[model samples]
Target chain A: MGQTNNDERTPTLLDDMFSVANKRDQAALARLFDHFVPRIRAFCLTAQPGSNLMADDIAQEVLIRIWNKAHTYNPESASLNTWVFTIARNARIDYLRKNGRYQTGIDPDFLWADDEDENADPFREAQQKRDQDTIRASLKQLPSDQRQVLAKVYLEGKTHKETSEELNIPLGTIKSRVRLALNKLTVIIRR
Target chain B: MIRYHPSIELLTEYSSGSLSLAKAVAVSAHLEHCKECRTQAHKLELVGAELFSDPAIPTSDQQLNQLKTNLLSKITNGEIESSFDKYGQAAPSVRMSKLQSGRPLSSESKYQIPKSLRQLIPSFYDDLKWMSLSPAVKIATLSNEKDGTQVALTRIKAGAFIPSHTHTGDEFTLVLEGAFSDESGVYKKGDFISRDARHKHKPVVTKDAECICLTVTEAPIEFTGWFTRLLNPILRKHHPSTS
Candidate 1:
C-alpha cells in the first residue's frame, strides 16, 4: 500500500503528524505515538541491551518529550525525523545518566546482519540499512581495529571482558582500544 | 582554556541523551552564550535520527499509550520538574538572592557570575592590584582574587576610543550599565563578552551615553604602538577601578 519509499514517506508523515502534534491534536499525537514508540524501542534495544531498561519505558519517555516539546520544534533548523529521534536519543541518555547502572553495550548482531534477507519486514530492513550506512560512512574513516572494537563494544553490546576474550587481547588493552575507538568515532560522527 | 566548540558529535550525543552529567552541565553553560554551537547542536540532532532508525520496531501502541498516561501524570505531578531543574532549565533568569549567595561579601549589589565562572575567581576581591588604561578603562590584577587573574571596569566616555590592544589571556566582561561595540558585536546591559587570547579589537562607546562594565581578565593587554606604550604608564597608574 505504501508507494513512495520510507525515506520520503516516513518524514512527510512524521512532519504532518508533528505539525498536528505541535497543535496538541490528540489524533495526530496518537499517530505519532504509533509510529515512533516502536522505532525508539527497537533502537534502544539494539544500542543498549540487557541493561534492565524496558524498551516500553524508554519509548514512553521519548513520546512524552515529543508531546511536551512539540511546540518548540523548528523545521527550519532540523528535519522532523531528526527532531523526533533527537528527542528519543536524549530520553535514553537521560535515563541512563540518572540510573547510573545502565550499560551501553553494542550488539554483534548489528554487524553480521548487513546481508540479511529483505523479505523479513521492509521497514525494519530499510531502517537497519540506513543506520548501517551511517555507522559505516562515519566509522570508515577510523582505523579498522578501532572500528572493530567499537562495533563490538559499543554497537554489539559486548563487555570489555568478553571482547578481550573474543579478540584474544588483555582486558586493559581492550578498554584502551575501545576508548580510542570511541574518540575516533566521535570525531567522525561530529564531522 | 578549552574552546567551547559544541562540536556536532558532542551535541548529537547530548541530544541523543548519552552525554555524562558533569560535561553536560558545562556544555549547557557554554550553550547559553554561544549561538554558533547551539545551531551546530541542533543540526547534529537531525543527523542522529537517521542513525537510530530500526527495521523491526519494538514497543507497541498500547505500551506507548500507557507510558503517555504515566508521563502526563508525572508531569502534572511535578516529577519532571526535578529533572528539568538539574539542567538549569527551570529558571534561566538569575535571582538577586541566588547571586548574593554565590559571591563573597561585596558592599555593592553582588554581581553573580555563573557557578563555573565563579570558581575561576578566588574568594577575596580586595587583593587584586589596580591599573588604568584611560580615564574610563581601568584594569586590576586579580592575583589575590584568583591565581594571577585580573578584573577591570572600563568607563567609556561618550564618544571615546578604547585604543586597540591584543589579548594575551582570557578576558571577561559583564555590562553592568551602558553599552559599547567592537568588530565582533555590540554588548549592552547584562550582556557578557568573553574574549580568548586570539581576539584583537577595539571598542567605542556611543556619543549619547558612557559605557561602564565589570571585566575579569586573565592576562595583560599588549599595547600595539609607540603612542599607546607612552600612554600605557599614565593609564596603568591612574585606573579609577580601585576597590
Candidate 2:
C-alpha cells in the first residue's frame, strides 16, 4: 500500500508493530497502546453502553493480544487497523461469551482463527490495498439509512434481527439495507 | 467445487462477529472449502475495520493514563512474561501434532477434521459417542447453546436413507464427508444447505461412500414418517429446546 502524505500514522504504526514483534520493545507497545486502546474501548462501549468496566476489560485484553500475536500481523494481507479491529472484535465476542448472557462452550479463537493465505505476492497486496481504499471511500457515500444498519452490525454488535427490533424496522428491511450498503461498498460482489 | 454457500446476510453477520457462535461454526466450516465466501467475508471485514477506525470516543486524559500505567506495570512486573511463556510452550502447532500422533491407525485416518471443529473433536470422528437414531443414521451431539441451538454431527451409512423430516426452526447443515441427495439437490463436502420450517424432504446418501455432516439446528427437527415420528421426542429431548 502506498503511503499517502496525509496518512503518516499507518507507517508509524507499522514500524511500531514490527518493533514490538521483532524486538519486544515496550516503548513500541506503549505507542500501540495509545493508538488502539481508546478505539477498542469505544468499540466495546458501543456494544455495551454504560459498561465502562466491560469496555476497559476488553481494551486491555485486545492490547495484550496484540502484544502476544504481533508477529502474526501481515501488512500485505490486511491493514493494521483491520488486523487490530478483528482482535478487538473477537475479544468482545469472547468477553460476552464468558461473562454476558451469551454463554456458550464454543471458542471464538478457533472460529475466527487467522487463516490468511501464506502465499503473499505483490499483485495480491496491490489488490488488497485497492479493495481497502475502495471500501473506505465508498463507505462515506452510503446513504444515512444504509450506513446506520452497517454501524449497528459492525459497531454496535447487533445482528440484523436485533437491529430490526431496536430500530423498529422489519427484519427484511434491515437485511435489504445491509445488502444495499455492502453493494455500494463493493464489499460483497455477487458471484 | 462447493455449490450452496451461506447467504450474504449470514456472511456479513459472521464477518462482523454479530452471528451467534453456533451459526458461525457452520459458516466457518463452509469457508474452509469455499474460497469465494472467504473472499467475500474478508472484504466485509475490511468494511468493519474502516468503520472501526472512525474517530475515537475521546477518553479523558486521566483515565487513559491510568489504563496505560496499569498495563505497563503488569508488563514490567513480568506478569505478561509468565503468560507469554505459557502460550509459547502450548502453541497450537505443538498441540495439533500431539493430537495427530495419538490418532488410531485405520482407514478413516485420512479424514481430516475441519480446523474449526478440531476444538471439539480432538482426533477422529469415530471417537465421538455417536448415538443411533436409526439403523442407518447416527448422531453425536457436539454442543448445545444456551439459546436452545444444537450443533451436532450426523453420520449416515452408505446408500442409507434419512426419513423425511421438517425443521421446527432454521437448520444449517455443512457436508463434512461424502455426499447426500435430497429433493432440493445433491450436497457434497463443503456445501452449506440451510433449511427452514417450510422444507420437508428425505436425504439419501450416495452408495459409493458414507456421508458425515455437521449440522446446527436452532430447534429440533421433526420426522414425518409414522415410525420416525416416534423419534421426534428423542430428538427434542436431546436438543436443548425441549429439555
Candidate 3:
C-alpha cells in the first residue's frame, strides 16, 4: 500500500474526504484536511493531559494516512464512516500504546483484502453493513448513561474496569449498563 | 475472569466497538459461519450507532465533514487488514452453539445440537418427547436414565411467576426472550444465567413481555414450600424420564 503525508483540510469532511481520497482525488484531500485538522487537534489537545503542541503533529500524521491509502477504500465492503472511525480508533490506540496507556493495533492483512470468495459471494458484506446501519439507528434511542458506557468501553477502547474508574462508578454498574444498553439496543435494532 | 463465549460477548463488543481489531477480526470470521451471533452482532452494532446520535453534539455540517475526513485518512493503508483464516474469532466449540441458538425455542425445525451439549446425552435425546410447560414453557426428557437428569425449555408467559425454588444441581438458564427477574436482577434476551448448586430463587417475568429460557439441569427443583412440594410429584410424573 502507498503512503502520503499532507495537511490542509479539517476533520469534519472526513467521510467525503475518504471517498475522494480512495479515488486518489487531490482536491478532496484539500477539503478533507481543511475540515478535520482543527477537530483532530482539539481532540488530541483535550484528550491528552499535556499536549497542545503535538496535537497538530498527530493530526498531520493522521491526515497523511488518508492521502496514501485512498486506493484501498471499499465502499461496497464498509461504510466510509466505519472505515474512518476504525482508523481513528487504531490511531488513538497507537498513541496510547506509545505512551504505555493502551495496547492495540490494526493488522495489515485484515484492512485491504475484501475476502471475495467466489463461492461465498462478496455482496453479502454490503447487505451486512446496511443491516448494521439500521441497528445503529435504533441504539440512538437509549438513555445517556448506557450510551456513555458503550462509547467509552467499545468506541474509546477502555476496559470495563478502566471505564469504572474513569467514570467513577462501580464495576457491577458497568456490566449492568452494558447489559441494559444491549437489551434496549436489541429491541430497537430488531424493529 | 468471567467465562463468556467469545463470539457472543466479542460480537456484542465488536458491534459496540468494544473489541480490539485483532479480536474483532477473529469475531468477524466466526460471524461469517455463525448466523445466530452475526445477527446479534449486527443488532448490537445498530444499537451503538443509535447511541451515537443521541448525544447532542454541536457539530455543524462542516465540522461533521471534517471529523469524517480525519478518521478516513488515519487507517487508509497503515497495515494490512488481518485475514479471517490467520486470526479468526476464538469460539470454543462448547460455547459456539450454546451461544448461537439464542432464541428461546428456535423456530428452525432442524435442531443441530452442539457437540459439547450433545455429548451429554445418548443418541436418543433428539427423539425425546417434548411437552409444554405452559403456553410458553416446553419440557423434554432428554435422559430416561436412572439419574433423572433432563433438558427442558421453559417458555414463561410475559407476566408469569415461576414458583421460587432451589436448584439441587447445576442449573444453566439461557434467555430466549423478553427478560426475567430473580432475586439477582433482570436478565434480558440472550443473557445466559448459569447457576451452580448454590443459587436458589423465584424468577418472575416482567410485565413488558414473556421470557422463554432454555434450561439444562442435572436434578429437579427442590420445591420451597409445602404446596410446592406436593406439586413436585405431579411435575415429576409429567417428565418423560422421571415417570
Candidate 4:
C-alpha cells in the first residue's frame, strides 16, 4: 500500500481541485495534472499492457473531463481520488467501447453516474471518511492471494471469469476470494 | 423496500468497471430503485479508488511533459468537449432524477423509463417495434451483444400467463412496470430476478395492469408446453445466439 506519500499529498490535491472548479485556475490544473496523469496512465497500461498510445489518449481524456466536470465533484460523497478514479475508469471503458472491443451501444456515462444523495450531511461525511480509512488499512492486512484477485479485477479490469482463467483457478475460488477480500475490507454490508 | 439485489461480487465488478455493459445496465437499473445497493456500490468504489491511487508507475518525463503541454494548450484554446454537449442536455438531470427517486415511476402519470435504458428507449416504450409472441405476450429488442446476450423488453398483457419456460442459459429480469408472479414469489417494480437453466415456471401478470420488464438473456429461453414449443425456432432465430 503506497499510503505515505498519498496521505500527505491528498489535502493539497483536494485544494487544487477546488481551485480548478471555482476559479478555473490553470496553475491548479497543472498541479493536479502533474499528480494524477502518471497514475491514470499507469491504470490504463495495467489493463492494456503495451498499449501506450491508448493509454495516453485515455489519460488526456480523463484530465480534460476533470477540468470540465470539476463543478460536479462533491467531496462529501467521494474523495478526490475516488472521483478521479471513476472518471478514469469510465474513460477507459468509453475508449474500449469505441475502439470496437465492447461493440455494444450501451454508454458508460449512464451506467456510472455520480450518485449525488440529497441527504449528505456531516454525519454521513464522517462515516464515509471512516470507511475510506478502514478500507485502506484493512487492504494491507489482506492475504496476498485475495489481494491479487482484487488487483486483477480492479486494476486489470478483468471479470471474475477472466481472472479465474488467467490465474488457473476455478471460478468458484475466484468468487470466494473476492468475497473473502471484501469481507476483510468490510466493503460488503449484509442486508 | 426493494428486496432482491445483485450479489456483492456483481456489485464489486460493476463498481470496478469489469462487468459487461449489458449486465452493468441491469445493475444500474437496480441502483436507480435501491438506495441500499447504491450505498453499497459507493463503498465498493471507495475500494477501487484506493487501489487505483496505488503508487504511480513511473513514465518518461519527456512523454509526460509533452502530454501535459498538449492538454494545457487545448484548454487555453477552449477546445474542451463537454460530455453534456455530446450526450444531450438531458444527461445530467436524468442522473439526478434517477438517484433521487427510490420508488418505481409506475405511479406517475407516465412511465419513466430508467435512464440506463433510455439510449434504446427514447421517449416511450410504446415507440419500439414490438412483435407479438402470442395474444398475451410481446417483446421488443433493445440490444444484441456480440456474445449472444440479448437485452429486450417484455410486455405481458394484464392477467395473462406466459407459457411455462426454462432458460437455455442465465436470464436476468428487472421489472419495469406493474407486477408479475411465478411459482416462486411475486415480483414488483424494480425487483431483479435472476433465473438459470434450472428454473421453469409460468409467470402471470397482475390483473390490474400490464407488466413490462427489461430482460437480459444469455441465450434464448425454451418454452415447455407442447403448443408453445413451436415458437422455439422463432425465438432462437431472433436471439443473437442462434441467429
What TM-score, over all chains together, does every model reach?
Answer: 0.45, 0.91, 0.43, 0.91
Q: For each candidate, what's the DockQ?
A: 0.13, 0.56, 0.13, 0.61
Off by over 4 Å in 1: A1-4, A15-19, A22-24, A51-54, A102-191, B1-16, B31-36, B55-94, B98-243
Candidate 3 lDDT by residue in tens digits, B37-107: 54455445444333332324333346446544545544454432311222112223443454455724434
lDDT of 2 by residue, A1-191 (tens): 43373177678889999998899889988888887888888888889988899888877777777777789777877778888888778877878887855779887677875437545677777787788788877887889999999999999999999999999999999999999998888877776
Considering summed lDDT, which 10 consecutive residues are worst modelled in model 3 chain B? B82-91
TM-score of candidate 1 to 2 decimals: 0.45
Quote the lDDT for B109 in model 1. 37
Task: Tell me the whole-model lDDT of each prediction, alpha carbons only.
Answer: 0.52, 0.84, 0.51, 0.84
Inter-residue clash pairs, candidate 2: none
Best by DockQ: 4
Residue A95: error of model 2 in Å? Answer: 1.0
For candidate 4, write residues B47-122 as lDDT tens digits.
Answer: 9998987754553355788878888879746787644224313544543355466634443327877878877776
Q: Distance from true position, residue B54, model 4, in Å?
A: 0.5
- Worst lDDT 10-window in candidate 4 chain A: A113-122
- Per prediction, the TM-score for chain B is 0.43, 0.89, 0.45, 0.86
Residue B231 alpha-carbon offset, candidate 3, angstroms: 50
Count clashing residue pairs per candidate.
18, 0, 55, 0
lDDT (0-100) at residue B20 of candidate 3? Answer: 40
- CA deviation > 4 Å runs, candidate 4: A1-7, A115-117, B56-62, B80-89, B92-109
